[model samples]
Target: MAAPILKWKRLTNATGPSPRPRHGHRAVAIKDLMIIFGGGNEGIVDELHVYNTATNQWFIPALKGENPPGCAAYGFVCDGLSKILMFGGMIEYGKYSNELFELNATRWEWKKLKPKPPRNGSPPCPRLGHSFTLAGNKVFLFGGLANESDDPKNNIPKYLNDLYTLEMKVSTNTYAWETPLVGGDLPPPRESHTAVAYCDKNGSNYRLIVYGGMSGCRLGDLWVLDIGAMLWTKPTVFGIPPLPRSLHSSTIIGNKMYVFGGWVPLVMDDVKVAAHEKEWKCTNTLGCLNLDTMKWEHLTMEMVEDSMPRARAGHCAVATHTRLYIWSGRDGYRKAWNNQVCFKDLWFLETEKPVAPSRVQLVRASTNTLEVCWGAVPTAEAYILQLQKYDMPLTPAKTPTGNPPLSPMKATGVFRPAVVG
Candidate 1:
């Protein structure tokens, strides 16, 4: 139903120079813009590229303030509103850094944070491949690989399981570091694990869910940190946990944590090959964990698998109320003599809310402001207003986009909430 050229839409005029294929980059969403920073394709990259998710336009801004060092595999977290906090990362091919920086997305400014040292316990050591997670204004820094030797070429990685918090005073821009005394079954020291913040329906039990990472080798374990009780508990999960993986991307949408694409060993179902015939490789599999029940399930997209991004690792993914966006990572298998592939493409997967709203109504209160209402569902306890402004494809009007091009008005700006009641 569509022209071949239309099916192969490209960003030929992405404004500024296009980014080179890369891996290990960090991406964050600010409204409709995707801000991409430091990753390694050719050494470490420090340049910033912003892509308009709605318009297919790219703008590489010469930011106003000093940027973080050219780095990759660092601890990066966005505080939901505007502030982006980055912690330790690989400054160079084996050189690790422990400095922290904050980027004010509103002003496109950067400020290196000098945390006030804690009265007890040492601050986190230099690390890379760690988790920097945000719950409200406090940023949590967890396990990563720390180096003990100065020799970059011969340095041995020491796995870390330490936890620290950087409390941000948004108004004054001052920060304090704290080492919380945690109890219960502690997670083993590992790096490149996936961790996400979770909060229950009653707004109780803020927990951190940690999954598979590399210790001395790849591991498949799940651990949770109860922030309120300062306790760790390994919840009994249902179904098969994913094959041991690391360097994956995970995000919370509603009450589920969706994880996709990581360094996984060969799988019979994913590759359709015999067990012995398959080797370790990056995978494109998608899975999620229900925070309420602690269950894991592999998922497939509504669209065909061919349309999805290929197997990848070290990519970055972020979610809005109803969509997941993926960008830039290494692909291919891990072998001694094999050459891996890095990509600079961006992709998005649309997902319906677990509980969709019914009898939705909207009124234009003003030219820019709109009022919305919908029938609540019994299972839904939280709601987020997802605003989508349908835009014309950047191609010509006569372009065959598989449907009647903007000849008729299909522009809809409706609110889609993930958790609705």
Candidate 2:
């Protein structure tokens, strides 16, 4: 079988001042523009960077209103309006926040929302590495590390499995948070997992699909949350699944969810040492899950060595109709205190391609002649035709062919006016 064709091209000529090499940032597309905000390297980065997909240029717009302080690993989503909503992240190593902020895409302003009566008595705990997505008039948030301690000696972070939604009043332009009573089998508490909203064909049902993240170690589990029913279920899946990973990005395009680049731990023990030590590795492997069939397919691409981004985690990815944009992530490093390498470059994956022709037809023109027809292939320059004739099977009721009905005849021809007709 022929391998699937995929193309990855690193974007060049992104002019003007871009964000520094960082990770844990979030990006969202509004029309042709990509807005990137809030990541950290040496410290937290809170500035907003905008990239024009049409012009291939990057620029920072001066803003008004109160700006959120520098932070990383926050939840960000666009309301398909002029507003982009943000919530909950780590401002520093041991500090986390649950503040909500909005950015006016048109006016270039920031507004921190202060709800009079907070949802569920108070907002969700300050968190990082959570997944947030938009579905209809509501925004959903799930799973992240929270309640981190500032003390270096006891700096343990808490992972959560809770789910919350922000209900928006489109007419009045206000919103409220709601903690729905979810039932059924619940997934274990985890952080750094990714969730995407999937609406049914009739648009009557909405489902949020969650996949792969880390608890104490890496996890490769899949779960679904029915939005309307407020229930969670683990759907049985077929095909080879991706290995345990975290800090990856999953974007839904059509009936498939495309996952790109994350940290993968590889344990290597030294046999010679009395006390064997283990090592962790990271990868840039890419895969997709067929939502309709509940199957997983890992994609292998022909990538240029110099152009391909290194395997890393905490990066951000956003998808358009045909392309998946990956940008700004930390490189996979081994040591804790080692100077981490972050990327500022941008690259896109072209997931969709022209499909092969199908529904071929062969009509009998006469007793000894036939005409071949097929659907047009958009990317095909020409086509080939093959014809094979099999000998009739000998039976006891019928006379056996003496010469084995002669060798089956075979013919091959190029698809053209002279041959097809």
Candidate 3:
């Protein structure tokens, strides 16, 4: 089922001095390559890693000059074109930078940017662990906690629900930015959520759906921004909302969005013996929702013996046209992580189209009898077959020379057809 590791399967240890181990670094695939920038593990790390998908190799094109320093949980969006933009991220000492950086593909360099001023209402403050989604040529950012203040301990944590957009304007050798404030009711402030872009109505209205994150407390609420109208709307439906979660992974498949495991709120015990007796509830459910119909459904394994992935949070999920890929993150109870086991396993989700019906033919045994034969339908939800019989008139002598009188018949039923292993 597999082959031994080859020269290409193994990669050389990273070049240049290794930076401090970091977490919450954001990655985006651009032109068949994955670019990963800073996250918060040590301080803000400025080193960037470029992974080549085709070769399974890691390449660090020697940095020519200054790059974005170590930051955590910043907004990283790769517009379909070929640019990866990085926004605010938290540094050591709990300081967040409002600086912006754009990684150029052709030159293989990073360019720092000073964002344009806001047009109307107060602009989004510099924050980390926010959500970013690119629609058309504009990138949208929403919801994260900003600088901490001590006016009052109870209300000092400012969780923002405001939305901001970075619009890229292309002109005759002149390129500028536009920051548009989103309007209408918005969801509560959230961080560490996933936001994905999907086109609606061919390419007219685009939808950016966000799910799972932490505000003052953890949340599992769903909110969407209509990219074309620049409005926010909440989805209302039946079934339990995904268990209150944060650091979960979500990706889109067609019009449906699938979310995997994440950490939920849990009580921690101060003593050892008491912790063992405590019953901890960590959700292991996988769920999805249809954006158009506002219908939600949870996924269950098809076979009883099928092995499922281990529960994890802070993992990342990315959807191709057909399959969804998941990467590593931490697992275990909220406060007590048994061990840090970052996963690198890849799984495939096979979705196939409905098979077409086979042809059917009718045989005539005599003038008054008929027999039909057809191959068994693989997934025969229902079947239809037609037959025609000849009818004789009372005055047979008149000699009806036309084709047999048509008598249509349909066979509709469920029969378990034979299946091949």
Candidate 4:
């Protein structure tokens, strides 16, 4: 079988108000837009950054109402639609918050859903690096490091394995949290792991798979939380699992979960003699976990021109159908880590391989006339060119002599050219 070639392309030359270089920030893709929030640079940042994936544009949206206090290591998750919810994070070295806030991406507004200490009075404690995953109407939050004290200044970090759910009443536009009575052998306390739900396209509730984090050192445990049963089961994962890692990001695309960029401990007995420079290493290696077979498969990734992002952890990754976008994370480790070395770059990893330049282009354009042309797609035989009347406000046109790289149009591949205006 041919290995999966990860064709990487770094995004550069983007103009507009972009967020400063930060780590521990979170990002989610809604429709065609990627929304970023929380995380830290020199200090914590509360502003919101939006990147238009289609146009390769960045805009720091002027958000209405109040944002959560500057914080990082919080729970930031998309509701798979137009809303993103945040819960519990550290404001600074000695301060943390358990406040929950909601951002309506469509309206670009922020509303505090559950206030600190919560109206229910039973919210999850102040924590960092927790999983705040949205599945259907319920958002399940699993393990993270938390401080048991009610005082914000007592920032002693304690690993927790407790579980809670916040269910949204979409009819009334409200939500509440419930501590589920979970059964089965509970996974150990940890933080910086990934908990992704295997939900339907419509965001129907499904299984929550939690994997890899750090307790004291790094962890490699695989745990599954069944939604209907309210139980946690440790699955015997097949194939060579990823090394014990923390602060990694994993996204479930279709039936496979893609894992990338995490702080991995490199003290395996088999690799004692390996010429590795560091005892711990941050890796940018990509691995796939097949949900159907409960097996992990190695994806042999081949990058074109060696353009992938470097090894880093605490970055955020989200998928738009077939494409994976990763942005900003911390790279070094231990005492060698420098705060100023955090990355601010953005990159796209094409899951498919050997990207060939598109055969479609704008052939000619005049003041009153425009002509577009395209050649056949490989193993395909049909093409369609769509020209819609320009209704959306157009910016002042740039150089009038450029062609946009073609967007793939899939069809029967059996018919000749057709144009619709």
lDDT of 2 at 47: 86
- Give one digit per residue, the lDDT tens place, for model 1 in 70-130: 8888987886678788888999766899898989888889988798877697778888999
The worst-scoring run of ten residues by lDDT in candidate 1 lies at 2-11
What is the number of backbone collisions in each predicted candidate, taken in the order shown?
2, 1, 3, 2
Best prediction by TM-score: 4
Per-residue error (Å), model 3, residue 135:
0.9
**C-alpha positional error of residue 367 in candidate 2 after TM-score superposition, expressed in Å:** 47
Higher-TM-score candidate among 1 and 3? 1
Which pairs clash (backbone N, Cα, C closer than 3 Å) in model 1? 376-421, 377-421
List TM-score per model, in order. Answer: 0.77, 0.78, 0.67, 0.79
Model 3, 1-421: lDDT tens digits are 3322111011234343333333466677664455667654324466686655434456777665347787767888887456778888666444666677877766777778766656565556677778877788778777776766533233345666667777665654222345565777878877777788888767778888888687655676787788778788886856656666777767776777777777665643334422232333344456777777877764444433234555667555554333444444555453432234444433334322224345555444455565656675432335544333435465534328765534332232221222221
Error of 3 at 117 (Å): 0.9
Error of 4 at 306 (Å): 3.7
Give lDDT per model, in order. 0.75, 0.77, 0.60, 0.76
Model 3 TM-score (2 dp): 0.67
| lDDT of model 1, residue 261 | 84
Model 1 lDDT vs. the true structure? 0.75
lDDT of 3: 0.60
- Model 4's alpha-carbon lDDT is 0.76
Cα deviation at 168, candidate 2, in Å, is: 1.9
